[model samples]
Target chain A: MKKNITPYLFAAPAFLVLGYFSILPMLQTAYYSTLEYSFFGPHRFIGAANYVRLFTDPHFWATLLNSLLFLSVTPVLMVVSLTLALSVRNLLRGARIVRLMLFLPVVTPVVIAGIVWRWIFTEETGLLNHLLSLASVGPVRWLTEFPTNLVSAMLVTVWRGMGYYMMLFLAGLALVPREVEEAGILDGATPLQQVWHVLLPLLRPTLLFVAVVSSSAAVKVFTEQYILIPGAPLDNKALVSFLYRHAFERFDFGYGSAAGMVLFGMTLLFSYTQVRLMDREQSS
Target chain B: MRKALSRIVIITASAAAVIPFLWLAATSVKGAEELFVYPPTFIPRTFQWENYTGVWNAIPFGLYLVNSLTVALLSVVFNLLLSSLAGFALARYRFRYRGLLFGAVLFSMMVPKEMLVIPLFTSVLRLHLADSLLGVVLPFAVEGMGIFLMRQAFLALPRDVEEAAVMDGAAPLRLWWSVMLPMVRPSLAALAIFTFIGSWGDFLWPMVVLKSQEHYTVQVGLSMMLGTFVDNYRYVAAGSLLALLPVALLFILMQRHFERGLLSGSGK
Candidate 1:
């Protein structure tokens, strides 16, 4: 009995903290979504009113559409990061330094990186425009403009993610049996063919992992958009940023909680798929 | 030709990865007039080391730095202690509901942090931890990833060692402290550094809770600074580089552990 109790005691702190901070809040987020609450007023039972408002709200739809658009960047991220991983895989020298350089952006805080990228994307006196001016091109506004603003913000996401997904790909690459590659060579497969036929099937798990994680992150993107273009119009904000604006900035907690529930649902779907895939892999 | 092409690709990619640092460093030193030049020079003609000093004084940058360091260090300490305790229990004990408890940890891992913010802020306020560094550290103190990583490490330990320790009449806590903890030192190191980095770089939660300028972390401080010092990019650049210094140093020192941690954290 003492021994059984000892294990419980050892685990109690962790469960306590996680229960209060993580599990409890998750339930509260669900509960709060059903109420009419704000800084100006007390909590009132609104029942489905917040969700109804969320569904009818044009800003909510636009923000959700923007999140889906952001999710489209995952394929670009996968290709770029996988290419980066492949490019460096065979290098016998300087690979470590290359990796360190590439991973620097990942290590930099999003606010700092967003600030640097913001300066770079400035229409005039920015390094990017300065480079384009050498070819006598008109300086294009990168951040404030409609589509370019979202595109530039997405570029930052891609930039920070490159080294991260590359590392994941490299880890997956390390697990592939070497004799399989040799067999492909004996079959007279070119490098690209070897990749397509030999390597990709093995990398399906990693690709799925990257796809799920990056897409979920894209849906939850807030800092990059917030920092890059501080007052970006309604169409430009990601779903999380919209939630943030309503909840914190405007003190509309119910509205924000409803948006949060939607974001949570989307992320939960991705995470569930990832868990299923991982479990399948383990069982096999 | 193949090698050369790959080299060019590698080199261009490396430059793309690194040039931002060089550009940021160069910009941090340039005079205000030089910043407006049609083609910004790669090298600053005059060194403005004073910008670092200026930005340091512009806001309570020193206070923010201290707050960030304290919060990160506290997070590392708490995460190591709590996660390892929980991990050891899960790995060694044959308690009922062990699988259920572990499943709960995994489920919590899947909960996106964005969903937790509003509710967490409310929780923090209820606990009277709002506007404090503890507010930033409490939710992340025992991360699911840390618990999972430590559990894996403990499970990998040879069973004979624990049996030997038990034969010596050592209590469970003694066995954990003297035998088990040292065995999983590498995992602890990885969790420590990762937790420190995560806490240090955290922006959104800190931004939400830390209302006073005195309590802000460097990330929160920098975001606010960006709005006030809109015209002075040099100061902001200097402040950013200064904030980045410790993390860069830690990464260089612990790159191997970081790489290993990254792969393991992803369950690869």
Candidate 2:
């Protein structure tokens, strides 16, 4: 009895804090998502009206499509980083320095990254446009345009993220036994064949983990859009930014919560499906 | 031949990875005229070192720095002590609902942070703690990643040491402090490094909860440097360089621990 009491006492502080801050708030979100409330006054029970409104809204659908578009870049980043990792895995010297350089941006704040990239994407005096001019191309309004804004955001995401994913892939590569490679090489297998047939199979678990994390990150991407391109620019649109303007700027907490809940649901569904699919692949 | 090709690939990839950061630093020094040159100046003709001073004067960056440091440091101390205790319990003791509690902790990791922000903001406001450093630090003090890392570290330890301490009439608290804690130094260091990095880099929650400019974190303060499309890009860049200093230093000083922390925290 004393022994059990001691353990609980030890764990109580953290659990209490986390419970009050994390669990309780989550419960409140679930509760409030069911109600119609605002900062100004009297609240009313609305059952699933918020969710109903969310599904019916075209903007919600647009944001959902935007999120999907944002997510498409993760695979491109994954392939690029994996290839980079594979290319650099064998270096006996300067590899650690190379790895460190790649991972530096991951450690830097996303806000800073967003701001810096915004400067680079600026229309007239931006670094990207300035460089492009040297190639005889006209200046492009990267952030001021719709699809271009999304593309610019994706570029920043890829640049900031690829190194971190490369490190993870490097870790995965480290775990691959050398004898498998040696055997493949002895059998006159090409390097690509060896990687395809031997290394990739062993890397399945790591691939799945990266896929889920990166995908979830892609969906919740707000800082980049918010900092780089604040508004739709008379033609462009950002789903999360639009949601932010509605919630905080306009004080539409109920609507914002509804949007957040939808985003959360989509993220969970996507990540869960990916995890399960990967699990099935591993077992098979 | 393969090795030569690998070298070329690595060089090209590394160049692509690092060029943006280099350009940022270079552009920070370039004059307004040089910035918009037809052919971009990779090197600035005149270094504008005053951009740092200008940026510092433009905002209450000093206050923001203090606010961010205090909140982050306090949060780190709280997390290290609380998480180590919880992690020790989870690792060493058998209690009713032990699995349930551990499972709950793991399950919390899956819930996207965006889902919680609305409720969290409401709760903080209800408690009348909004727009304060306490509001910022309190919620973050109990971290899932820290506990997870510490728990894994504790599990990897030898049981014989604790059993011997028990035979020596050492209380659990004494054993934890004097024996177990010392053994998990690497894990503790890892947690500290990661926690500090996360706290320092965090922007979204601070943006939501902190209303007063006095309580703004460095990230938020930096954002204030850009107002209504009338930004001084050089100053903002200089401020960003300043803001990045601590995190970069922390990473370099504790690179090993940072790597371990990231690996364990991410379950990679």
Candidate 3:
């Protein structure tokens, strides 16, 4: 009993803090989602009216579509970065520095990355446009167009995140026992054949982690869209960005909470399904 | 040879990776006239070192730097202390709901922070803690990732050492501070570096909570610089460079530990 109490005492501070800041707030959001509460409030319980309104709202659907579009980019990034990792996995020299370079963007703030890329993709005096002009391709209004803005945001997201995923892939690659690879090679298998037949199978867990994390991150990407193209031409708002505007800007707290709940539900479901599948894969 | 070709590939890949940052740094030094050249100046003719000074003076950057450092340090200290305690419990103790508590922590990790922004803001507002440093730091202090990392690190330690400490009449706190913590120094260092970099780079939370100019973080200040009509590209670039410098240095200084932390955290 004393021993059990001691552990609870040790864990108390952290749980209390998490409870206050994270758990309590989450509950509060759920409560507020059912009520017509704003910052300036004469509040009344509305019993899922906000959610009902949220479903019918055009902007909500647009935001959901934008989130879907944002999510599609993650698999492409994962494949690219993982491929890069696989390509360089066997290289002996300077792999560390290359890995470092890939992970550099992960440390840089998302807003800063968005700002810098905004400059790169700027229409008139942008570096990308200037480069494109030499090839007579485009002065693309990247941050202005409907799907283009989303694409532009996705491009920056991929560029910034690829390195981090690459590092993860590198770690996964390292875990692929060298002896196993050597055995495959000795058995008259080519390098590609060894990787395909032996290494990729061993990397299942890491691949699943990357897929789940990148997908979750894709869903929650607010800083890029918020910083680069806030309400860009009416049709380019990401879900989280729209949620931000609703909650903070318009003071529509209840509606925003409903959106938050939806996002939470979607992320939870996706993560659950991924983890379960991965665990099943591991067990089998 | 394959070796030579691989070397070329690495060099090219690294170059592609680094070019944008190099461009950002170079553009920071170019004069306004050279910035918009037809053929963009890869190298600035006259390095306008004043752009650094200019951006520094343009905003309350000195104050902003202090605010950022203060918030990040507080967050680091809070996270280190609270997470270490939680990790010790989770690792060492066999409580009734240990699995449940651990599950809660894991669940917190999956919940998107953006989803909680509305309720968090309302809570902070209700507490009348909005636009304050404490408000900004408090919420971020209890990170699930830090707790999870520390718990994993602690669990990896041999139980005999801790048992020996207890047999030698060392209390739980003493055992933790002296024996267990020192054993997990690398993990703690890794957590510190991760938390420091994360807090330093945080923008949205600071932007939401910090209303006063005096309390603005570096990211917020930089964003404000962009919002203002002052179209000084050099200054903006310089500010961006300065904002990035500390984190870059932090990464370089703790590269090994950072890599280890990333590997462990990603469950690789």
Candidate 4:
């Protein structure tokens, strides 16, 4: 190839767009986090006052806790999705139907999914309550209740996630060598032992991918909490929802920016650790 | 016996995964009286197609649909053209800061969207792009995954093609457009499907930016309708169905490319 500025010119558009929208906003967000921004008063530098408020605000702590609690769905999603992948691997029946049905939610708009779920949890006319009544159970408050609301939201997230991750695991499972599985049989390992010792080690990359993606999604979750539990009840609000209410609803830019920074830091830390773990897996 | 057990597990799991969508379909057509009935009919006795039209009449989903299509199509066009170009630059050429630029792209993927919402909104407001579809589209028009996928696609191609083109006096743009892009058809298709679906489903940014009801995307429209239709379960269900239908069908139609997007996105 001849030496020229062509490569630079080719790459210019994407870099410029990302620089304006992604890189610059991040810096502005960092700066906003330190200010006492007000709608009426002149804005002034507060030097971490917003973060300080975050430490003292129990609501902030609760939202952070709720966000972390949402991550409890990660392992469950991985195990269930992977198990489904493994189970369907040798199936001679219903494979196409099963695959289509499971993966459907991955493409559904989150807001739409959340809205449908909201009706499913309706106290008087909900599908769940009606089904529970078959066993003579009273209508259980799902979204209005505390831990149950959290659980319901997590269940939705997990349900929506399983098939997407199942595909990943299936992709990984396909890569495992047939000779390796046969060697397990030659070594007299049971099928369960073969899965535990051989298949899982080979599936590590997909499993890590599922874990990282699921956790990151769990933390950034907004539409579900926004639609399912409108107004973002303090007890059940995720971190992003809290940021929305403060920043957009309250017009409290500084506090929202502070919360946003905390959320961003946690996401970065979590993703960095995940990348490092995957790298370790590769190097080993 | 083991076969039977696995069948049972697979069936049960698929049902769990699919029942909500089934319920969504059912509720979309159920009459007002049947929605609250005991042991709710798994299938509606009366499939009230009117519910669809009712919600259609109630909300400006027509406008919302147009807005969504505009943003998603533009995002797709920009992503396909720009990401492939960027990918070619990184994969086929020796450029300054190429490694750094690629690293930046990878790093952008890790930064959660939650972190950037406030600042992006502030940026949008500052630029007077607030309340327009442009703000909604601006944040995501050039996807990181698109560039990454296109780069991977380009890297897999033989190097000789570009050299041959250059030897024939094909300019950089011509080499990328006429020679190189046609080779990565699969990736371009995958990126198009992925970006279109993502842009269509996007809620948070659009909800924040678009103050006017007319500018609301499908997701934003449905969310706002969700608040107003608290008592109108049928209408809400219809709205939800409307929000989901287009992209859901698109996914069904283009399942192959969408699946490829998923496969490449979950990098090994």
Q: What is the i-RMS of every prediction?
A: 1.6, 3.1, 2.6, 2.2
Q: Pick the candidate with the highest TM-score.
A: 1
Candidate 3 lDDT tens digits, A48-155: 899899989888898888887788877888777776776677677776777888778889887778777877777787778888999998878898887888888888
lDDT of 4: 0.83
lDDT of each: 0.87, 0.79, 0.81, 0.83
- Give the TM-score ranking, best first: 1, 4, 3, 2
Which consecutive 10 residues in model 2 chain A have the weakest lDDT in total? A274-283
Q: After superposition, how far is residue A251 of candidate 4 from its true place, in Å?
A: 1.1
The C-alpha RMSD of each candidate to the native structure, in angstroms, is: 1.6, 2.7, 2.4, 2.1
DockQ for model 1?
0.69
Lowest-sum lDDT 10-residue window in model 4 chain B: B259-268
After the best TM-score superposition of candidate 1, give how far the Cα of residue A89 lies from its true spot, in angstroms.
1.3
Indicate which candidate wins on DockQ.
Answer: 1
lDDT of 1 at A65: 88
Model 1 agreement with the true structure over B1-268: per-residue lDDT tens digits: 7577667777877787788888889889988888768677889899999999999887889998999999999999999999999999999888987898788777887788988999999888889999999999998888776787888888878779888987899999999999999989888988988888888888989999999999999999999989998888899899999999888889889999989888766647
Instruction: List TM-scores for all candidates, in order.
Output: 0.97, 0.94, 0.94, 0.95
Candidate ranking (DockQ, best to worst): 1, 4, 3, 2
DockQ of 2: 0.56
Sliding window of 10 residues with minimal summed lDDT for model 4 chain A? A275-284
Candidate 3 local lDDT, residue B118: 81
On DockQ, the stronger of 3 and 4 is 4
Scored against the true structure, residue B258 in model 4 reaches a CA lDDT of: 76
| Comparing 2 and 4 on DockQ, the stronger one | 4
Clashes of each: 0, 0, 0, 0
